[model samples]
Target: MNQMALDKAAVLAEALPYIRQFSGKTVVIKYGGAAMAAADLKAAVMQDIALMKYVGMHPVVVHGGGPEVSSMARQMGIEPRFVDGLRVTDAETMAIAQMVLVGKTNREIVTHLCAQGVKAVGLSGQDAGLIRAVPHRHRSARTGEEVDLGFVGDVAAVDTAVLETLTTAGYVPVIAPIGLGPEGQPYNINADTVAGAIAAALKAEKLVLLTDVEGVRADRDDPGSLLSRVTVQEIREWMADGRLEGGMIPKLQCCITALEAGVNRVHIIDGRVPHSLLLEIFTHEGVGTMVVK
Candidate 1:
């Protein structure tokens, strides 16, 4: 065979196992970080999702627009604030969140997927009451005191019927995490938490988080210290040892929560790399960390 044929065969070989494993199975992706801002990376991510759909894997995209919302708020002279890493949403901030997340970001992703020849539909958690939540209480990191961040919520339940309907109809569901509260009020939800809830509700085969870094590292300073695979117990041990701290702490917590809730596996990958999703999901040597139940 010629070199071109050999390369084609190798590419197919790398993808066959993943195609077999995920075909007809649902995979929920929580897309964020650099991929959301970088135009090239965003295009790559859409292409990867399109290819996944073409190969028979069902994918649901759940996205976050924290940075964009904050930027827009700043432009509007509303200073962004956070309590315990959760955005403190005042009435104005809540409106901005909805505009940026559900309106701007969601539509952009849907447009990109369509441009890539994928059938895509954008929906907020408010649509069809897909995700319901109650106001979330912010806990102090130092004293562990609980304070309510009005209009900010954690997902209490997800009605997966809409998601299933869209996927069954050959449309990729692009979800924004703005949910309705118990009182029929709209609330801003953490995207990672929202993704986990959706994955658990769907009993998805995998939950993939696209972030800025290359997965979880044993040493924060060393990129080579990546833990290729970890279990729930091992993550607990890392937390106990104070190795998992700061921003990564909540990400790992989300992964552990999803795994406990019946997600078969969760992966964390660097969104800056082109086709990172496909590399992490299909290749033998995955590009990021994988957490299994």
Candidate 2:
């Protein structure tokens, strides 16, 4: 056999044990970044999720479409605004977010999975109370005062009954990050936060976050400084010493929360890489940083 064919065989052999180990386990994936933006990466992600289902693992997708929302808002002559990195969602902005996230993004993901020969259902937090939301208050670092981000909310609770039913019936669930408020209002939520909460509620085997950058690194500038694995304690220390900052801080905090809430592992991987989800799950030398309890 040729070298290429031999390598394929080697890869399959390497994945066999992991496949068996995680068979029938649930994996929650936060789909975003370049993976959702690029056509090729989007196809690869859907393929990876389909392969996981075929191999006896349950895969749940939670997706974000912030750029898409902003683009749409701009087209409608509304300028998008942000405070403390969280979108300042007004009533009109919330409508656009819902239209983009639930109506457009969610259905597109479902269609992709269906094309891969899997049963896919698109849903939002409004469906079956899958997510209960409360207003997300942002404390401005510049002013040291609280700011109300209209229609921006945090996950208060996740009801997994619908999710449980869908997965048990061999269907993949694609969720948009729009949550339902106490007064039947819809709020825009962060997809990563939604993914973490869903994983916690389901007690998933893995909560995988697809990001634009490589996993956590000892030095942000050095690609070679990527830490293959880290523990909750180590993450706490980094946060304490100010080594972690910006968007990564919130993501790591989500990871730590998922770990403490009974998720077996959480991974921060570069979604820009083709088949990154498969590589992280099936390979011994994973392509991301994994967090553990």
Score every model by TM-score. Answer: 0.95, 0.97
- Candidate 2 deviant stretches above 4 angstroms: none
Tens-digit lDDT track of model 1 for 1-293? 99999999999988898899889999999999999898899889999999999999999999998999999999999999887688889888999999999889999999999999999999999999899988887787778898767789888889999999999999999999999988788999888888888998998999999999889887888978988988889889988987776667767887887888899989998898999999988988988899886
- Backbone clashes for every candidate come to 0, 0
Residue range 118-147, candidate 2, lDDT tens digits:
999999999999999999878985797999
User: Which residue pairs clash within candidate 2?
Assistant: none
> Lowest summed lDDT over 10 consecutive residues: which window, candidate 2?
241-250
**lDDT of candidates 1 onward, in order:** 0.90, 0.94
Estimate the lDDT of model 1.
0.90
Candidate 2 residue 163 Cα shift, in angstroms, is: 0.4
